[model samples]
Target: MNEIETAPSGEWQDVAARDQLDPDFPLGVEVNGQPIGLYLLGDQVHAIEDVCPHAEALLSQGFVENGVVECPLHGAQFDIATGKCLVEIGERDVRCFPVRVVDGRVSIKIVPV
Candidate 1:
């Protein structure tokens, strides 16, 4: 008998249409097996890593209050827009990704700088 293997699909699928994501609630989507936090702030969609750097916690699982994600583990806060760690004093920031919505589709660019 012979077996075949398949490659993983590309990331950034059209998880939600433009009409599905309301301006009031942020939408959470998984791309390439990674949790991506999506928020529509000021006519633009922002995507960030859903994991809190301080601990092994999912930011999406936490509460999204006032443009900041409060880490349910240690109560650390992170700025979703810039992926900046609010609790940490130094330049410890969470990973941020570029997001784009075209033709009523949402996509994420995870290219590192």
Candidate 2:
């Protein structure tokens, strides 16, 4: 399993390797002790909160169509790029993080809400 965990003192946390991630699937990782979903499209990577705000489902297990990820629990759709709740099932927006690739590894900058 990927070993992404809480970063110390709100620092950027190294989550996973670029080579280990599947471009079509969202990987669930932890950043600053919070669950985050990671997605790769072409050379770009995006990060969002992993849990669906509408229900108790992991966004990583959800389906990504176009730029939106549909929540598996209730079919709520969330935009991967901006973490917007496109379907409006929930008023809450998923927290998005700034991602970086350094030396073939992926790191995420956690921003507190």
Candidate 3:
């Protein structure tokens, strides 16, 4: 289990340790019970909804290259840093979460629907 810390605004929740993340891969984690995809590009970590907006594929399960996550179902690519659908196969854009690194922990800001 990981320790969770809430932010002053009660939105950002600590989800995982920075050391636990793989720089070469994307990690799937739950923040406030919502599935999220965590990607480590260079020294920065980006957070987006785990489910691809275009299909039923998990972004964490797809191939990640150059800060872009490619959907395995249709080859549509999304920019993890902005959650923008780079190659639009449909009118779908992934939701992005605000990410922060505090004291070696990865914190994600999750807004309830």
Regions of model 2 farther than 4 Å from truth:
1-3
What TM-score, computed on C-alpha atoms, does each candidate reach? Answer: 0.72, 0.90, 0.84
- TM-score-best of 2 and 3: 2
Off by over 4 Å in 3: 1-10
Error of 1 at 51 (Å): 1.1
- Ranking of models by lDDT: 2, 3, 1
Clashing pairs in model 3?
none
Error at 39, model 2, angstroms? 0.1
Q: Is candidate 1 or candidate 3 better by TM-score?
A: 3
Instruction: List model 3 lDDT by residue over 15-80, tens digit each.
Output: 888998886678887655567888898899898988776666777878888888888788888888
Worst 10 residues of 2 by lDDT: 1-10
Write the residue-wise lDDT of candidate 1 on 9-73 in tens digits: 43444555666554455566666666667777667777787767776677766667777877777
Which candidate leads the pack in lDDT? 2
State the lDDT of candidate 2 residue by residue for 1-113, as single tens digits: 24465667456788988886776788887655678888987788998888888776888888887888889888888888999888878558888889999999988888665
Residue pairs in candidate 2 whose N, alpha carbon or C atoms collide under 3 angstroms? none
**Candidate 1 clashing pairs?**
none
